[model samples]
Target: MPSSKDAVIASLIKSFEAAPRREQPYPHWYLEHCLPTADVAELTALPFPAPALGGISGKREIHNATRQYFDAANMEKYPACKTLNEALQD
Candidate 1:
């Protein structure tokens, strides 16, 4: 059986190849359930960094919102997140 990672890569390739190439009224495509159920759950469970909407208003809220992105050291600490990142890169 193909590993989950392999399955995801295959799915991505298939999705891209099968995507409509012709110009339409509006260009758009969506892949439903692209990731496996477990991956979806894992990704969903991750604590996403809150958007710094207030930053747009010059409230200095961007500091807190963007902190998570600059914390690269923590990325390797979470195995699930690391794996997900690798999968995305593939």
Candidate 2:
């Protein structure tokens, strides 16, 4: 059986691979732009906590942190994100 950490990493990879590629009507533009430039290899190289078997907090933290990084990097482009952010901010 794979160790817990291995299983977690595998699951994360699977989830990313399985995520649908459909575009959102008003997509998160920062994410859309950043993904092509984002270094998945570098990200996977970072040390992260082993995934929790039952709790979502671990995954949530990873997701939120990545979002924050993308948001900060793309803040200047927020004007372009008008439609999506407006709906989200309300």
Superposing all C-alpha atoms, what RMSD in Å does each candidate have to the true structure?
4.8, 15.6
Worst 10 residues of 2 by lDDT: 29-38
lDDT (Cα atoms) of all candidates against the true structure: 0.59, 0.38
Query: Who wins the TM-score comparison?
Result: 1
Give per-residue CA lDDT, model 2, range 1-90, as digits (tens). 112333334444555566655568753322222221123433333344554445445455555533433244343443223322333344
lDDT score, residue 7, model 2?
Answer: 37
Candidate 1 has what TM-score? 0.54
Global CA lDDT computed for model 2: 0.38
Clashes of each: 0, 0
Instruction: Give the lDDT of residue 52 in candidate 1.
Output: 49
Give TM-scores for every candidate, taking all chains together and pairing residue i with residue i: 0.54, 0.24
